[model samples]
Target: MTMEIGLNLFSVFKELNEDYFGTLEKVAEMGYKNLELITVNFSTCERYTDTFSLPVIMKKFEDLGLKAFSAHEGVAPGSVIIDADWDRIIEENAELGCQSIVFPMAFISGREDTLQTAEHLNLIGKKCKEAGLSFYYHNHAHEFRRIGETSLFDLLAENTDPSLVKFELDLVWVMRGGYDPLTLLEKLGERCDMVHQKDLGMHVNPVNLFTATPQGTNLDTMKIYTEFVKPNDFVNLGTGIVNFQETYQKLRQLGYIRYAIVENEGQLGIKFTSIESDLKVMEKYVQGL
Candidate 1:
């Protein structure tokens, strides 16, 4: 369970409560030693500003004797969403001292051109490698969706140059996809670099039939995601659903020394104290496992 715990500041993402410093302080208080940050201000597609907030924010972590090991960078919404000026994004990331650039995203349809995705990723990775920065992909459950007995993600992974595209494991989502996270991790081997320690409580909701239906023709919620995990985003580690203790134990047994980032996506809308309680529970459980 104790595998380099870090925090993603993008979680409590609202303009009103942009308490980046307070969030960092809270994470530091809870024994987290690393942080993953997001940089750039996206006012528009044609005209975006590089706030360079990461350098100053990263120093705050350094001041706390913590490492801002990885960053999410300018890639957003979709893992396969290739930026037109990918080099610019990479350059900005290098400027912030981001050791790794993580493409943590939901896979987009028609973006299933694995060859193109691989080319884009490989191109970026080559640059990052040359610049002494690593690159990775963080998965959501949709990455496991298949076409002709092979997943689009698998196709992308298999086709990509190993030296270029490393994986940033998101264990909970992997498990939710009905595949054992470790099995997939081992499948990729050393191409796997970092990890996202999002534990999906204890309940596996049986592939969720309702979420499988078309959006707008919906029966239930109108959350961020068109379908899948947006509804269940509130479930904290080892609590409502996923067996985090056993999962962490298995991960350790497999010799995966990656960061297990605790990301409470959309859970911030709830009681803050309750969220803190869940975090404590996760911390304790991870330590003992």
Candidate 2:
């Protein structure tokens, strides 16, 4: 029931461009055993070290004692869509030594869009499974928008085949989306084997974003509001309102999850110390796990 703590490279994404090897070394020195790599350009399928080949990147990972646990396949021009070249994508990630392929974010306006997205994820998951890798969908607040009585997230979950399409739950987003993180995790059950651990600040305006916006706003419009979110809205783990200790302990009891990756977005800069603090707070929270 123990879980390994790791860092989502997006925490220091910009640092990678300035000094890829150095940044990774610092992360490894910070005691991160795993990393969730971010895709720089989904158009060319470019990652952090675009100039270097996959083998070279793999060597760096081995040298630094960091495992490429998963990657964020973002939504951009020429991104990994339903019609993309799955064979090539799977082959590359498998070669890079990734255990899972995670689609970090998606934008859907309604139930039809949600269902169609689920189908797309299922197909991608099927290919990943065939290639011996798991496929997961990461969530954001937009997913919690309603399509009638059910949230788009629930509709998408209902439509996707559990065996094929899994989930990488993001705790902060669950709270921002107006759902209790624990309740959603309980509902996801075994379908979620990983999570993004970010804290919700005490002063984060309209804590439940759904409450501020119109009840029936579509995801596309909701995305605009999120883009306007201020960087100061996020704070260090323990300083925020999120109950990481309780959440991590519950995940341990669930007994299926193995990795809890800390993600710090829009808070990178001289704030690398904040990420370090976040890790320490998480370590304290899951002391027994």
Candidate 3:
């Protein structure tokens, strides 16, 4: 299928609070036809699984004319994925009708940490494959740090099995990592199945591009990581420095057909006017493509 526009529920996590179903309803109403789920509360998952069941949750999405395309497992960095939990994870996502499961981020201190993260990814990716689901690793700016001549991201990509472990490239973070998004996209090629469509507003300081932050930092203190981000650094789709037109063109040329999830992480205390506005921006850009 040709790739379509979707919203990462994380963009509106704070606004929605713990209203998981309410968020889905609001997002669909806002004209987002697809969703990339982020687990804000583990209880929310249990509530759905225990009371409604996976099919019921899927039905809820169907009722609203929305598709749950993918979900972030939302595990913390450096945490081991126990083998026993693999079945539960796979089953939950399968029932949600997710085509892929993504490991959002991993805390890597150095070369050793990077290697350990890669091993964990491969292990999880293997189990995900056994359950008939694609597994992917989502990137942040920290992955751009070099271990030697190659980046940590390159190490993970090189070590993991491409068939089992694809990548979800976050464009904004790619720029923040001091690399051209297009160059990274070219490097990943077919291994890239999804891209996070976040825009960077003007006034970004390239000098602070590679500033590394420790992984698994408290969510409440996330704003500290945005110390380098200007007030307008995070923005909606077409309103910022990211060249969506050229990026989409490259994706098409590369025959990349995967979801483009609009993610506006409200870091630096910066918030978008509304999620609806963000969705509108993406819709207009995708239509033009």
Candidate 4:
């Protein structure tokens, strides 16, 4: 099965501030048929809840010729689980025609936190299953830290119910974590349904979860690191170290035919040029596949 190419709306969060609907229209115009929503604030959440109901949002997507396949909810650990607000969250996404609800990132401290995260994911996954949506965990580099001999990511994969919890593997962050992306894919196997396609320019140090920059220094403050020492950062796909051709071949071999979402946290560096270039690169990759 061939995977569909999609955009994680977070890639253009800054541009969306200028023109919300227009930004989405631009994405559709760029040939992206699917979108993965990112909810970072109440205002963003209310954009979907207060301004547009699920059916209204669905109609808008249909009009734009786009499909809402998945959504990333809650930025951190404390906010990731299902709570009193889950019904509304689930209802809204369900109405928007989203099949997956992904917890984008969790600021984990150690083994205990990792286990707690796994338990929370199981609970959330159960809730999602009851609501007819699948639950997934999107990883960053922190998950690669070793808990004894087993990586926290492996622990999470081993502990969670395979049917309840899957993963959205961020290949760039996997590389940042100093692990082979394909090796992790081999381990996760069928538990991985979605992928975040990104590439790294240099070797970034493993994230310090307790520190100020969990996901690397913000692009704005990147100059600070450069003044003292060079900082490894995300670069556009194909222009970086990731081998997409090999990665795509492995995904096909593993039967990963779900969404392959192109993501660029470094869009600020190249603005829209690199994003468009990377999308075209992914488009070409998908066509060849």
Worst 10 residues of 4 by lDDT: 215-224
Candidate 3 — which residues are off by over 4 angstroms? 42-52, 82-84, 206-208, 211-232, 267-273
Candidate 1 TM-score versus the reference: 0.79
Model 2 lDDT, residue 38, Cα: 77
Task: Give the candidates in order of TM-score, highest first.
Answer: 2, 3, 4, 1
Model 4 alpha-carbon drift over 4 Å, by segment: 41-47, 75-80, 202-232, 268-270
Question: What stretches of model 1 exceed 4 Å from their correct place?
Answer: 15-17, 40-49, 52-55, 74-84, 110-112, 201-204, 208-224, 266-275
The digit string of per-residue lDDT tens for model 3 on 1-289 reads 4778888877877655556578778777778898888744544434345554676678889999988889888554335654336678788888888889988887664677778878888888888999889999998877876656888788888888897889999987887777888888888887886899887766555432544333322222234355545656676666667777788777777777577788886464434355677777767666562
| CA RMSD, predictions in order | 4.4, 2.5, 4.0, 4.8
Candidate 2: 10-residue stretch with minimal lDDT: 215-224
lDDT over C-alpha atoms for residue 63 of model 3: 95
Please say which candidate is ahead in TM-score: 1 or 2: 2
Which residue runs of candidate 2 sit more than 4 Å off their true CA positions?
41-45, 77-80, 214-219, 222-228, 266-269
User: Which of the numbered candidates is closest to the native, going by highest TM-score?
Assistant: 2
Per-model TM against the reference:
0.79, 0.91, 0.86, 0.85
Answer with 2 or 3, whichever has the higher lDDT.
2
lDDT (Cα, 0-100) at 73 in candidate 4: 82
**Top candidate (lDDT):** 2
lDDT of 2 by residue, 1-289 (tens): 6678878888887777677788888888887788888746333445544667777888999998999888876565334378665677678778888899888877775787778889899889999999999999999887887767888899889999999999999988887778887888888898898999887677776456766655536435445455546677678777877777678778888888878889887463465787888788878876552
Model 2 lDDT on a 0 to 1 scale: 0.79
